[model samples]
Target: MSDTFSPRTLGILGGGQLAQMLALAAIPLGVRVVALEPDPQAGARLCAEHLCVPYTDPAGLARLAKCDAVTLEFENVPLEALDFLEGRVPVRPGRGLLAHSKHRAREKEGLRAAGAGTADFAVIEAESDLAGALAQLGGQGILKTSELGYDGKGQRRVQSDAELRAAWDDLGRVPCVLEGLVPFTREVSLGVARTASGNLAFGPLVENVHRDGILRTSVYTGGDQRAEAQAREIARAVAEAWGLEGLMTLEFFELPGGELLVNEVAPRVHNSGHLTQDGGGVSQFAAQVRAVLGLPLQGWKPPLPTAMVNVVGVDGLDGQALEPDWGAIDALPGTQIHLYHKAHRQGRKLGHVNLTAPDAETLRSRLAELERLIP
Candidate 1:
């Protein structure tokens, strides 16, 4: 590992709030970021030092010429483009991890290869494969995912064998995975970071609540001795397996019998850990910056009790934006607000609030206050 963490220039593949937050974290390290996105009005566009021409453009390849290390804000980046820049600039997490993250089938295979536990599933390459998958599951199941799917998109729940064909067509008969739904008691996530030198660190398991299949709140469960230990081991194996560098998140399901099963993996800073900004002494964004830059590990502390509420913007929010209301939420001590500047769009993630207290009850109360304040 290099003694110094400084990089002349850092290039980011997507220009969303994640990139914006990453740029915010890199500021103290004196590193400038170059962002690549098609939208000039993207959230991170204003924050990055230099915005590259466009992803997959020849000019974008030219922009990579100026960067020392590159990272992705999202998993949808064209792999061919990253392949062109790999030898020239350091791409944290590397191409293999990125490739695995893009597809659900491959992700499960990677997890199995790493000796990690995951939900029972089968690969679906064509419509015929769907029937074979259903036969294997032997009962009601779900068509796992299409490569680029997010936020409940590109998935269908099949109740009977009859629905399998329709579900397959609904997903455009694309390559996917079919997973046996688990009757899990709760869903949680453990965010982890790995440096180039194999140093690993993990945040505690967070209890996640989802609405419409998108994460709504992530509350700290705090010190589940067994789950925490298993989570750390799982995260470490993932990092070691991919020989991954930088940050990634592992979402897990706590089964009825007290066993933990892997849910999904995000090879980047995740929405579930947004609370780290105020709860943990080290925010996930800050940790990611440090890891990607090869900085030394630091202290890890949890905000004994904390709750993170995601703020989703609905249309016609501009009227409410002018008189932004945080009075009730702000009244709570140790509360922090993070707003992403994005144009009004239905169900778009606007920002989040991290409220902390001595216990989950107090944290819930503060979150209730925040809900009332959201205009």
Candidate 2:
């Protein structure tokens, strides 16, 4: 094993805030980062070598291949772009993991194969399959596209054949999955890190709160020992099944009966894991930098009783700007504010607040207050 993490220049496939934070983590360790993104003002431009071009632009891909290694900031990077870099650069966590992250049906299949439980679902390849798939799931399901869906986009709740057909059509008649809704008590997410040597580390199995199908907050409230252990074990199993080599975040639905149903997975640093940057410990971004360089993994967990609230900005389509009261947020005790260098847009994550307390109850209270103040 290498005594030092070796990727002197890391390449990221997208230049969103996740890329921004990843570069911030890497720079402290003397690793330079390059980001290829179409958005000229993308967040990573502040901290990384920005290539403001499409993901598949030949010149952009050529520049990325010059980096020591490559990874994704988001899962939707076109597979052909990866194919172009396969032998030219090391793409940690690789294209197979990206494949599952890109397609809901493949993600479920991979999860089941990995000994992780998922909500019962049927694949809809066409309109003729939608009715039977709906009936198989008790005639009620969330119809979601197999690819290119996130947040509340590309999904619809349907209870009948007509509704299912309509959802399929509305979603552009793409391949889809209709999943039975689980009777969940809460949603949770776990960030897992693995290395080429097969070492594994885990973040807390933190409870997550979402609104309008987007994550609003993630809180690690001195979580249940048994459930946390189970979540980590499941993550390890999934990592093995998926050939994971760096950071990945998995979403789960915690049922009232104390079981977990895997909901979704992301191949890079996640919105829910943003609290990792605080607490004076190794973050998912740091771990990713190390993993991509083949460095040893360290620090399995973060300080307990931490929470993060996303600062969603105003509706840009309404021609509004976010004039945040920065002083007000800074005045709140233990709050660390991180803003992405991007314009305010509705449904876009502009920044986040991470805070901690000596215990879980106080942390939850602070989180509620922070959430109220974010907008």
Candidate 3:
């Protein structure tokens, strides 16, 4: 919490590309990162010191508690694990934020309570609640599990009572939320970082394109002053309302009338913000590290139009077949490629490329060329 701080240790609770990137960002600041993850092959292990243990392992938690502060890469980390580390060491954007964001019902409630616009939704605890909830949502809705849903997993679109029943049964009859679908023009996300002292920094509003519910590309499209202001306002409000002390991302559905409806919240660095690494003055990972350490936030918009494309593993391909043509991608101008050291699996994120150009047309041309070369 001091301005005159020196190199220190930081703890991360998950080990994915997000954690890996966070670790990489912290390196230049002289901060050492220790990541606790059960997977030995976790990409984060490439940069940070690895604990290599279950998150529930007491010894692992104890090791994490010894660090200067703790944070998480993914929102799905157990609340109990966070609770255990709460007072022992600083846990920025703590358990309360995690709990609120992890459950679909609670996240929507929090958004409503904050006076933020969100789609109409109802909680469904049983099959009987499905029809009524769908009816409340105007007969078409997305049935999503209350927890552990991501990238289109644990969700089903239902327009009929029969489909609703099947969706409920398919999801193991768990508690769910039936949300009305928004007639959105495009999906944009705002990434904001805040410190315990309330200092804030925002990344550019990114327009995202998704394939099979997985984010395919995030393009920096911030020339619209009105829309940009609204997006930043929504992000700041959510951060303050949640008393957040680290990075948080708000995914919004921009309506045809220019109204923004909060769609989801990720209580940590988000995939949509991946372009920040090359596009923004301060990357989300760097801002997160600064915030958790109680340092002042610093950032500015990118000088050029930038686009990020996710390299996802193709379905029905083994690890060898899933290998991308990295050589070809690296040949493009003003392009930065990041490959996460992860084993190839169906639909898994393998890497991403950040492309920057003097103008949107040039960026689009480069992206099209890259797409053709990707295997």
TM-score of each: 0.92, 0.95, 0.95
- lDDT tens digits by residue: candidate 2, 1-375: 234844389999999898999999999877999999999989999999999999999999999999988998878888789889999998987987877878999999999999999999999986577657877888798989999888879999999989988888888898999999788999988888888778887877778898888888888765678888888889989998899978898999999888988999988778888887886678878888878767777753666678898888765455776555678778888889998977777778888889987788888787777777766
Model 3 stretches with alpha carbons more than 4 Å out: 1-3, 315-323
**Residue-level lDDT tens digits of model 1 in 1-375:** 234654557788888899999888777777788888787777777778655466888778668646777888888778777878877778887888887777798889998899889989988886567666776786878885648888888889987777887888778878878888888999988888888888887876788888887778888747577877888888888889978888889999899887888888898899988887777577788788778777776534475677787877644545443323677667778688888887765667888888788777777776777656664
Give the clashing residue pairs of candidate 1, or none.
none
lDDT ranking from best to worst?
Answer: 3, 2, 1
> What shift in Å separates residue 292 of candidate 3 from its native position after superposition?
0.9
Candidate 3: worst-modelled 10 consecutive residues by lDDT: 315-324
Q: Worst ten-residue run, lDDT, model 1?
A: 315-324
RMSD of each: 2.7, 2.0, 1.9
